[model samples]
Structure formats: structure tokens, C-alpha cells
Target: MKKIQLFIFAILLSSTSVFAQSDATKKADKHFAKFQFVDAIEAYNKLIEKGEGNAYIYSRLAEANYNIFSTVESEKWYAKAIEAGASEPEMLFKYSEMLKANGKYEASNVQMDKFASMRPADDRAVMYKANPEYLSKILDKGKKFNVQSLDLNSNMSDFGGTLQDGKLYITSSRNASRKNYGWNEEPFLDIYEYTVAEDGSYQAENLLDGKINTKYHEGIVSFTPDGKTMFFSRESFFENIYEKDSVSNTKYSVLHLFKAKKGSNGFSEVEALPINSQNYSIKNPTISQDGSIIYFASDMPGGFGKFDIYKATLDANGNVGTPVNMGQKVNTEGQEMFPYVSSNNTLYFSSTGHLGLGGMDVFYTKEIDGKLAPIRNVGIPINSNGDDFAFRMNEETGEGFVSSNREGGKGSDDIYAIKKLQPLCDVLIVGTVLDEKTGKPVSGALTTLVDANGNVLASKPANTDGKVEYIVECDTPTELKVTMEGYESNKVAVKGSNEEEVAVTVNLKPIEEIITPEQVVLNPIYFDFDKSNITARAAFELDNLVQVMNKYPDMVIQATSHTDFRGSKQYNQGLSERRAQTTIQYVISKGIDASRISASGRGETEPAVDCKPCTDQEHELNRRSQFFITSGGPKK
Candidate 1:
């Protein structure tokens, strides 16, 4: 009887422990399912401490931490889950991303390799295989902005700042009096305002008008040029609109746009936009400078990715038109969010679909030929291996704001003030090499970029389209040199100013054009005013005549020099005679047979451009030398 009672007690104790573990697991699952990641992380961690953790619990913990951007914690739990053979294909991808976010590139690549093998057709896997060495190039990109953290940030999530009408509007979850949000255990986001001084100092931190700040989430705001109208994103809960899950009896609220009128005291007359639907989310709105259009992000049906950037036209009477997708040029098979339109109508947004430095990166696209151009990454300092979004800028001010969850922030997501160091400092030297006479592409032409000091920066051959492009640093004096066999080389000077792109056309003259039937026509040989000596430029032109003569040993040349209508007739004749002698001597010095070259002087008898009142340019044109092939010609 004693042995029976002891065994029964042991069994009861074991049953009780099992029941407790089940309760803990159930509680953690509930929190995670509700998107209460903070609470779920706590519950899952308790299970691990009690030595009852399984692969499922570990993965949940990893996902929970990842949702809140707890990089170190997420990486740890993901590693553990992966080690225990709990890695799903999606889990492997998440683990790889977490590894990259922590800067463990080698480890991330290993996980990515596994992911690619498992999901060969996934876009992420395809991107990984295509550019396995993208990290170095991303890191080497020049910094375009000097970013600094804002002092107004709280320990909670604070981001999405925009400046309008001398007030800085920011979205924040810093109100301790409000109800906690299950997403990250912080208060629900509200629109806050700060008075911005003329010198860019912030003051009078306070909540926005009660009409705009509701108990539900309110996000980034934009205003019209006249400051009489405002547009922003708000949770649908304010309108009591949500979709209920039949199984869990839970309601999901989607984000929608709202327009408000600015009254005498505060913003009022708020109304939901017509484009709002219970089926999808629409948020991160930015209005055009003229308030005629609004751009945003959404995950609506028929999109190319999880989210895509969209825009809608707005009328003066506050009516919005149908939303149109930005298309594949801007959207991809991943998340694209937080669309911001600059004063100059440039569209900037954050994306995970695009090739970036492992996380959401900001990119900008502008209209070209009435359509959106190919998007380009905004580059580093404004972006990182963390979620970077909510980019707002005033192109006139050269200042902006960006939000990021990168390391060393005071909160989950912190707002940063960005001052433009320089506008992307990359000058694109792009052009086509063409025949001078035919205007057709000169294929196989070698194009080189040279700096002011004549150092070759880059070289490339023209494509079949006769196009050659090189990216050089802005604010540097550069030149584009195009060379091809059987043609005269062409050099175009480019003044590397603030312009981002400079287009040029290199017109190459055929080598046969040099040896005309009558004259070995070189470029104008220039002599300074009242000077008979051959200048360096004049020497260069004279050498071409020598080259033509050398190519044909039997060729003899007659050179004639002329003067502008400036000096006395006798003096002009003397000057022209001396210039003619100098031109002949230059050719002789270049190994040309002195007997093969003869020269004469014409004192302004023949004028290229005849004008009663000659302009400076016309005068310079008349002061030139010409060479005629007196004998044999080039072998053609």
C-alpha cells in the first residue's frame, strides 16, 4: 500500500508539470498571434529558462524578436532554432537577414546559399546568387548626407518627421497615458508637433490638435503649398472599420488616408479618403508641392510585391482620383514603403525588394520623358543594414529627415535629421561617338575620361549604339576623349559643375578627310594679336600638316598666312610674311623636308566671314593659315 501511494504521487506531480508547460506554451502563442511581440518574447524566454523550450518555441521567439528589430536577440534565437533542425525555408531566409543585420556577412552568405538551394525561384534567392559580393560595393558608395540623431526621440518608437509651416510634425508612441500597443508594447502612435525656429532649433514639443490626435495610430503628414489643407494616414479603427477573423474572433484594422482642413485654431473637418478600403492598407502619404497629387505605399491587390508605391491625383475641392501603381521600374517583388515626394517632384521610398545593403534602403526616381526613370539607391549614412524609411526632404533647404531602426538608436525607431552634404556628387559623362559626315555611330571607339591633370580616370569602348558612359566625381574638371583607328580623335571639355549629367557628341572625322584633293585641310592655325611667333596651339596644328606630308613622301605643300583687318597695310604684310615663315619652320622641325614645303603671305585679301563691323570671333577667323597639297596625295 505504501509503494502504491508513492507512485501515484509521482504521477500526479508529473502531470501537473506537463499542464504548466502547456499553459505557458498556449499563453506565448496567444501573445504572438495577437502581434504582442514584447509580451510573446517574455513568455517564450521563460519557457527556455524552465528547460521546456522546443524548436517551435525557439522559432517563435526568433520571429518575435525580429518583429521588434531586436537584432542581437533575434540572431541568437534564430541560430538556436536553426541548430535544432527547426529551419523552414522561410525561417532560413529570416535567419540570413538577421545575420546580415548583425554584420555577420560570411555567416549570412552560408545561410543564403542554403536558402537559394531550397527556393531557387524566389526573387530573394535569385538576387543573392546574382550579386554574392554586393556588400563591399555598397559599403564603398560615397556618403551623400550627414545624418544625426534627434534629441526629441523617446525610448519608444518615434519616427516619420516632416516640416511644414514652421512646425515639425512627427509620429510617435511616446504618450505614457495612452493604451499600450500590442505590436511593441508602446503607446499607439500619435501626431506630435514641435515649433521649428528659423535657425533650425526645435521647441514647444506638444501633441497636435486633439482633432487630429486620436487614440488610434496616426502617421506621417503632408500639407499643401498654401498650408490650408493636410493629408495623413490613420488607422481605420477611428471609423470603426475592420475585418473580423471567424476563427479567432479578432478584428484587423487597416490604415487609410484622411484629409483635414486647417481652421483658425487647429485642423478640423477631417474625413476619410474615398480610396480607403477594408481589404488593403494605404499609408505614408506625401502631397505634391501644388497639392494636386499625393503619393503613398500600399499592399493592395494586383501589386507586384508585398507593398508597392502608388500615386493619386487630388483636386482643389479635396477629391482624390484612382490610385495607380508606379510599375516595375519602381516596385519589385518585395516590400516598398514610405513614399516621399520632394519639392522638385522626385519620388523617394524605402524598399527591401531592390538590391541594397541587406535591409530596407531608400531610393529615388524622377520622371524622364513623361515616365518614371529607373530607380537608384540613395546610398549610405541615410541607409543601413536596418529598416530605413520615412524619407522627407525640401530640395530648396537642402535638409530632410529619415527614420531608421539601425543600431545605437535611443528607441526602436529614431528620427534623424539629414543635411545634404552634396547632391550625390557623381557626374555622369555620357555621350555617343559618331561620324562627322554621316552622323552614324562609330562602333568600337575607345572613350576615356581624363581629369584636369590629364590622368586617365576610366576607359571604355563604345557599344553598338555608339554610346559610352563614365561616372566621375562632380566639381572636378574632366574631359572626354574618344579615339578610333582611321579617324581623327575628338576631345570634349566638360565643366564638372553641380550638374549630375553632361551629354556630349564626339564627331570623328575620317582620316581620308585630312588629305583633300586640293589642300591638306588642318584646323585653323591661330596666332595671337600683333604677334608673328608660333604659339603652342599653332604648333599642334602645324604638326598635322607635317604628318600628312610624311604619310606621302612625294607630297609637296604650299602654305599661306593671312592677317585680320587691323594693322597698316605694310605692317600687316610684314606680320603675315613672318607668320608664314614661322609655320614653315615648325613643319621642318618635325622631320619634314624643308624643300617640300613652300609658303606665302596674304594680308587679309581673303576673308572667311565678311562683315562691315567685324566681331572679335570673325577677326580671329581671318587670322589663320591654310595648306594646299601641291603634289602627291595620301594613298586612298
Candidate 2:
């Protein structure tokens, strides 16, 4: 009877151990779901230490690490899972994605093909094959940005450094050699400061002692342009969905923007910004030059991308306006965070969605008339194929700071400063001028420069190398027009305020002219894909052609339209004909002699550029309307 009791007790103990292990796993999974990867990793580590780990647990660990942008660790665990006999398609897909992200395109393609063959009907495989912006191909030609590790010494990770009041205010995850109650053990982050010396090195120090440095994750500190108010992100304790506790008030990550004003006794007590509260995580808050607009990164709903950057306007009464997502162009499927608006109104931020070298790279885009231009990769030195974040630029000098965990770094992550080195005005514009039909460089092409208006500024012929170099004042925006005889003119507009010089390669399409009995003059009109209506620019070109036709009153021409192979053959043929007729009608309406003009539609049958199974852009060569001269007679 005693032996039986001992056996029953052993079974009960085993059951209890299993239940504890399962609970730990559930808690880890909850943290993982909420993107609390650091916490999830710790939990998973504990489970593994208890020998309760399986291939599934390792895979989850790998995924969590990958989510936290820990590529090397993620790859290590992924390989372990594969070795553990995990043959799931998701595992293979994720491994391939990792390989592709790391620039192993051929190997990644092998895995991708295996994944595709295993699941032949999967749409992702087909999409990967047909995707123009292939992740592998783009990363292969990735430009190397210069990211040098600085020699600044701080006890903790120095990140999110901004320049204000002749001092560099930065955020650090360091504790000032004291035990503070606000110190959060779960991935603690905090704010710090440093003074910039003449030697361009930071004399780093902690800020507010332990006052502003919360126990939880706090990062990305920004001060208003006037240097009066300061804002930063704070993670707070709150109930999370994945956790089982009903009244779970334990510290979880939440982004709160705080405000503080400078006072005689250092700074006033930091207060939470009005819009920030117990709900939702917000980080990387940046104020506009005028302090009217506040931009920050958030995981809040209504964003187009994950952890998208949102902008809120502060009214005259200091009331925060509705938060608006920066839109798909600025944001992407990946996180867009750590925004810094330069004094010149250029918006600089970090993004993972755009084609970058790796991880989160710093990008800058100019805001013109409230619309953001395409985000431009800061490129080399400022950005690398690593997790580059928290970019702050000094308006007085074109120098800036970025945080990175790249190779040769002092620690897990370090703050690095980049000096423009090159003079702001010393910018080069280098590109090739190609013949639209042959795809060959055209030398001696006359490229003219103009201001934002149509006023001509400078004219230079393309050199023997088929490149044009123009030096202009970098204070104003400029437009470039490339022209050569017997080809369509090309124009590229570049804003010159912050950018040194604009480099653009122009492709000039051949002007097709038909010499016939009647005098005819017709202009080639370009359209976007699958669209019948003429664009405003195309209309402008057509107007120029109309003026030419009017100058030669007796000249008549035929408007010919064509299409690339995209839609059904019959559909393309009809669409092309309709497009040709539409052009003819538009010309006639412009007071051109109807009897002098004719229209014809020739679909994919006549392709100017024979790119079989071409890309959308290459197919555009077939989708165009041209003018064939029917006759050249005396002026009416």
C-alpha cells in the first residue's frame, strides 16, 4: 500500500511539472504575439533550460528573434529547427526569406524552389518568381553605406541622440550606478545626454539621473525647435491580451510621449503628452520646426504599415489633432520609425519596408506643398545593411547621428556620428542618356537646365561618354530638359534645396515621321499602363504638336496607337484603335484640320522595342501613339 502511494505521488508530481511547463510556454507565446520579443525570448530560454523544448519551441524562438531584427540568432535557431526534423513549409519559407534577406540569393532560390515544388499551387512562389522587385536581386546590388563605429564610451547603449542648446541629448539603457524603483527588468530603456566637443566626439553623461529613465523601455528623445519643450517615448505596465491574469497591471510596453521644460533647477518634472496614455505603444516622437506638428512611430490602428509613423498637429491652444498615417509611400509592410525633421523641412526617418541594404535603414524625403516625395535612401556612411535608427541631423552643420549594431561595433549597439565631409554645394549629377529604341547611350545630346518655372537656365551638350554634368546653385529647385533631333524630348525635375545635384538618366524615344503626299505633322503621346485617357503632360505635348500642325497649315498626319502584350489580344487591339481615335478627336477639337488628320491602331503587331515577355516598363515601349507625316504642303 505504501509503494502504491509513492507511485501515485510520482505521477502527480510529473503532472504538475508538465502543467508548469505548459503555462510557461503559453505565457511566452502571449508575449511573442504582442511583439514583446525580448520577454518572449527570456521565457523560451527558461523553458529550454528546463528541458521542455521541442522543435516547435525552437522555431518560435527563431521567429521571435527575427521579429526583433536579430538576424544571426534567428538563423541559428532556424537551422536548429531544420536539423530537428521540422519539415513544415513555413519553416522552409522563413529560412529562405532569411537567406534572401542576407543576400544569399542562389541558395535562397534553391530553398524557395523546394518550397514551391512541395506546395505547387502556392501563390507566393509564383509571386516571388514574377515579382519585379525581387528581394534577392535588389539586395545583390546593394550599395555599401559608410557606417563607422564611434569611439564614444557609455556604460549602456547610447541611442536616439538629438542636438539641442549646443548639447547632444541622447537616450541610453544605462542605470547610473543606483537601484531605481522605476527600473524595469523586462528590456529596460532610458534617456541620456552628451556634450558635443570640437573634436566631434561625445562627452557622454546620463540625464535627470534616474528621473526620466523609466524601468521599462524608453527611447527616442526629441526637443522642440525652440528648445523649450521635450518629448520622448515611455513603455508602461498594462494588461495584455495574451496574458492570463485578469488584473495584469505588471509593466508591459506602452509608448508615452512626455513633455518637459527647462528650468533653473535643471528641467521641470516630465509630464505625459495629452494624446499619450495607458493605451497603445508609441515611440520615437519628433516635433516639427514650428512645433505645430508632432510626428512619432506607433503601432496604433489606422496605419498603413506595421508600426507606421504618424503625424499629429498641435493647435494654437496646445490641443493635439487627429493622428494621420504618413501613408503607404512613406510607410511600408515593415516598420517606419525614428523620424527626424531637418531644419530645412526634409523628413528623415528609418524604414524596413523600402528596398534597403538590410534591417532598418535611414531615409530622407522632402516635403513639398504637404506631399512627401519618394523616400530617398540616405545611402552609404549614414546607412548600412544593418539596423540603423534614430537619425538626428544638425541644421547648423550637415553632420548627423545614427544608432547601429553593425559589425565592428563596440557593443550590441552604439551611437555613430557622420559628417557630410563633402561640401553641401559640391554635388555631382551623373547618369547616362540612352536612345529609346536601341537602348544605347546617345552622345552629344543637348541637355538644358531650367528653373522650376519654364525659364531656361543652362544648356550643355552630352559629352562623348553620353553624360551631362551641370553645376548650379543649390539654393533653389531646378528642372532639366534633355533634347536631341529626331527623338522625343525628356525632362526631369529636381529640387535643389537640400539635395546637392540631381542625377537622372533620360531615355529619348525616336520620333517616327511618315513622308507621304499630304503635309502632315503628328506628335507622339505617351500614356500610363492600360489607360486610354491622355495624361496632362501628354496633353501638353499634344498641344505643342497642334501648334506645329497649325504653323504648317497644309500638313496632315496619322495618329497611330499600339499596345504591349498584357490583356487579351482582341481587347488590346480594340483599346489601341480607340486610343488612336481619341487622339485624333482631341487634335481635331484643338482646331486642327480634321481632313488633314487620320488615325490607325496597330496593337502588339508593331513593337518599337522587341522585349519578348518584357516587364511592365519594357512593355511600355509598345504602348504609345505616334504621328506619321502624310504630307508637307504650303501654309494655309
Candidate 3:
């Protein structure tokens, strides 16, 4: 359930206690501020029964139920609050979320539309307005994974599973012997272990080592690559760390991460992480494959929401540095938790932030340029209109586990085994650069992978075989640009299927002209009738000569211009000389030496296609330019 709004609401309620006229209001406000939502709901309902309920009381009841995931109750109270003239934008937003959670999608969209109208500038509102049909798009994503409820799930909340060394470690509230937590009236969470047989079956579950499972809540656990070091979350009761609430006169213990070393019997040498603080909670730790960095969720100050994913460097001596927030790209003004990094460095996490079906949804992002790429929802069977989280995957085997609290489960939350049918947008692009004229490999050509907006994603020089490869998002508009010296640049669109490979061939035309004993041949640079200025077509042909001149600096060139038989000899000659001078100037502007170029005019005197009473087409073709190598040749 989302609690950041409750945290804000609690502070608001506590500060405005002086406005309370009834003892019942003060009593309920204190309970709500201290997170004793069960008591708060009872007290708030009592005021409503006595006909003393106002918009304030209704909003309080709505938020209290929302913090505890009472979907029906919260939805009911939110409607009442809105009807009672509660103008808080969050109330409408949460109302829509609760509607989605209960599978009332049409009602949800109605409420979301009202919320969007209220706060059009908010990211949530903007996203909704931009893609109101997001649900249909999400449904159309199809089933990317097949999910199966675990056989060992008990009639209690069981979630957050991680596998290592043929064992699955998960957190469960199944221990009836433990005292119940007031928040959910369930036994405190404890980390449990289950043996996995090679036959793809599970053995009986047991409590994790005594050193790790304490009386207070013991949440998820993660192991290092070698499985020699373990990190897990526990309530701060063991460390005697807590904060006292003035209103409820209660001392609340926050969750803190602890690290332990593996021994012959079990994990021991338990110690709290340095990032732990009594002021806020830090939990759900997952380490990278190299064991050099740890990723976790924290509610510490400076976070974007109730919980935000963070990473800290782990030194050789097992010391953790200051935590760094994963930034706004991966976090939002909602809870984000249960971050798992796959072997290939794809970071999978759960978020109530980013656009999703509903509740906390599983999202994945790849690392690009030491930062995260855009987040993508796993979609369909892997996510639902429920609190789906604690996602971890084995990329090599295409199997993984996820936890959810959707309908038809054995408990409030259950861990489900998932087999990936396909990836959302994993594509491998393979291509080769070749010469257009020769159909041979253009070795050492530079190739770039760019997005639809021309942003470069990756770039590299083609290998000796003219082959290049890149991994990019599928179904996204992308293009491959290839360039080589003495060759025209080429670009082609890249399209592929998810998790599939596609082949592309880029062909570049040669730009360098063949150095001949006489005039250098090039595409005809046609000039308009009676025009002396260089056109874009003329400039294009002149650029070829500029490239040739630059390639052979000592080589000199004579640019001669010709005209059709339509004009007088003197007039045509003057226009032709002007055209020749313009060509020389164009070449010089392209960084070629001016001294190596000379201009001349030949008016109707040297018509290669001589014809009496020529057609306009033939006369137009006669108005062209040619380049003759005056001195110097290609170096031997």
C-alpha cells in the first residue's frame, strides 16, 4: 500500500490539532498520525455514526484505509470524501487507484479524469491525458511470462523470494507464534528457507538461521555472487533504535539492513549496515553480481517518494559507502522497492510510480552510459491490478519468481514461479557495410545506431569483415548510419522482433572520382539557362572535385564551363566564365587551396553531343562543367 501520502497527511493532521472541536476528532487524529490505522478507523467511524462527519473526517478515513490496502473501504470513503467537498487532489488520485485495484477500470478512468482536470501539470495527470487508452495497450502486450503459484505457499502473506545454491529464501508472516503487528494484524515477518530439489520440486520450508530471524520483522534477504555474504532487513528493535511519536506516545521501530557471513552451520556475524538510521528506514537490499555495489530501497530524506531505490559501493573490506539515490528516472513520488539486478545488468524493480496497470508493478531498465534507460513495464501475466513486486529473474534459464496480492491467491500475498515466454523489447541487430557499386565489404567504416530523434545510442567502426552488431530496444524506431572515407554516407531503418535477431546491409556509393590522364569524370553538373550562379546540384558535383583535390594536395585542376547553342557566343561565353568562377569559389569554400584551381569558358564551341536544330533537352545537357587535371597525379 502507498504510505507517503499518509505520512504527509499525518503531519498535516498533527499540526492542525487545535482546530479539533471534539474529543473524538483529537483521538482519531492521534491514532492516524501514529500509524495506528485500525484504531484510527474505529474512532473516525464513530464520529460519522454520530452524524458529526465532515469532509475532514471522511478524508481521514479514506487515507487511513488506503495506507492499509483496504481497497473497498478506501474506495467507499474516498467517494464520500469527494462528495463531502474534499478538494484535495490526492484524494481523487487515490480513489482512482483504489478503483483500479478492485478491477473497476471504467470507474477508475472516470476518477482519474477528474484528478487530471484538478492537477493537469502533474506527471500522473499528464501521462493519463496523453494515453487514456493505456490499459488497452497494456493488455495488448500479451503474455510475456507464465505464472504459477508456488506449492509451498501458506495461508499467510509470503513474498520476496531469492534463489541461491539450490535454496529459496523468502519472507513470510506464517509464524503464528510471533506477536501480531498492529498494522496488518498478522504475525511479524520472518525470513524462511526452502530446499529446491534437482527434479524441479520444492521441499518443506523452515525458518532461516536463528541469527537472521529475530522477534521483530525480518524482511527479504539477498546473497552475494559467491553466496559467502548475506544481507537482509530486520526491524530496529534488536538495535534499540526507534523514534517516539508525541501524539500516540508510541515508539516505532524502523526497518534496517543487516549483513552476515556464511559459516558451516548457517550465516553469522550479523551487523547492521552503515546506511541505517533511526530517523528513516532502509531495507530490501540486493547486491550486484560482482559484489561491488548494493541496491536497496530507503525512505530516507531527499528521496522522491515513500521508498526509492538506492545503491552504495561496497569496498574490498566489506565497507559500504554513502547511499546514492537511483535518480528521478527510476523513481517517482510513490513507493519503489525490491530491486533485483539480473546477470546481464538489467535492473528489475517494483514501483507504484511509473504508469502501470495498477498498484505496484514490475518494471525493468537497462544501464546505458552509466545511467538507466527508460523504464518499461513487464506487462500482462507478470503484472496485474494488484500489488505485484519482489521480481527476480534468471536470464540464462528464462525462469524467475514474483510476488503478488491479486485475486485467487492462497494468502494476502504469494510468491509465484514465472517462466519467460519472450522479452518485452530485447533485440539484437546484426549488419554489414558494403560498397554500392562493387558489392564488396567497406572495411573500417564507421557505423552508428541512432534513435528516431537522431540521438546516437551506440557507435563503432565496422570490423575487417565490415560486420557490426548492436543490442537495442525492439519496436522502437531506430536507424543505422554508416560512413567511410571516399564513400557516400548511408542510413537505413532498423526493425526487429523482441528477443530476436535481424540482419541489415548498408551500401555506400564511392565519392572519389578515378584519376585519369585527361578530364576527371563526375556526375553531370547541369546549370539552368542563362544562369551564372552555382546551384545545389552544381555545388554537389564541385564537392567531389574538392574531395579529390584535398586527397591529392599537389594536384591542380582546370574547371571549364560550357553553354547551349541558344544564346550569342559572347553572351554565352560571359555566362560560362561566371559559372566557372562560381565553381572555383565553391570548391575553395570547401577548404581546398584556391591556387590549385583555374576557370575557363567555352561557349557552344566544344559541344560533345553536336546536333543541328538541337532539342531543348540536348541544349540543356550541353550547359555543364568538366574538370581537367592540369598537373600532379595520384602518388605512385
Q: Against the true structure, what is each candidate's TM-score?
A: 0.68, 0.60, 0.71
- Candidate 3, lDDT over the whole model: 0.80
Most TM-score-accurate candidate:
3
TM-score of 2: 0.60
In candidate 2, residue 531 scores what lDDT?
Answer: 72
Better of 1 and 3 by lDDT: 3
Candidate 1: tens digits of C-alpha lDDT, residues 1-636: 000010010011111121123556888776765667789889889889999877777778887787777778889988887786675776777788778888899998899899889989777777678667767756776787899999999898888888878899998889888898776778888899999977778899989876898998888898877888888988888898877756445567888899899988889999899998877888888888888888888878998877788998988887899999999868877678888877767788988777676568888877643556446678888988888888888788778899888888998889999999778555666778999999999999988777665656667788898997765555768778777766766678886676477889989987677777888888788887788888755764565676567667899999999888887878888899999998899888889889999899997787777765799998888887888888888655
Candidate with best lDDT: 3
Runs of candidate 3 exceeding 4 Å displacement: 1-21, 117-121, 428-473, 476-491, 500-636
lDDT of each: 0.78, 0.64, 0.80
* Candidate 2 per-residue lDDT over residues 557-584, each given as its tens digit: 8778899888888988988998888788
The alpha-carbon lDDT assigned to residue 158 of candidate 3 equals 87
Could you give the candidate ranking by lDDT, starting with the highest? 3, 1, 2
> What residue pairs clash in candidate 3, if any at all?
none
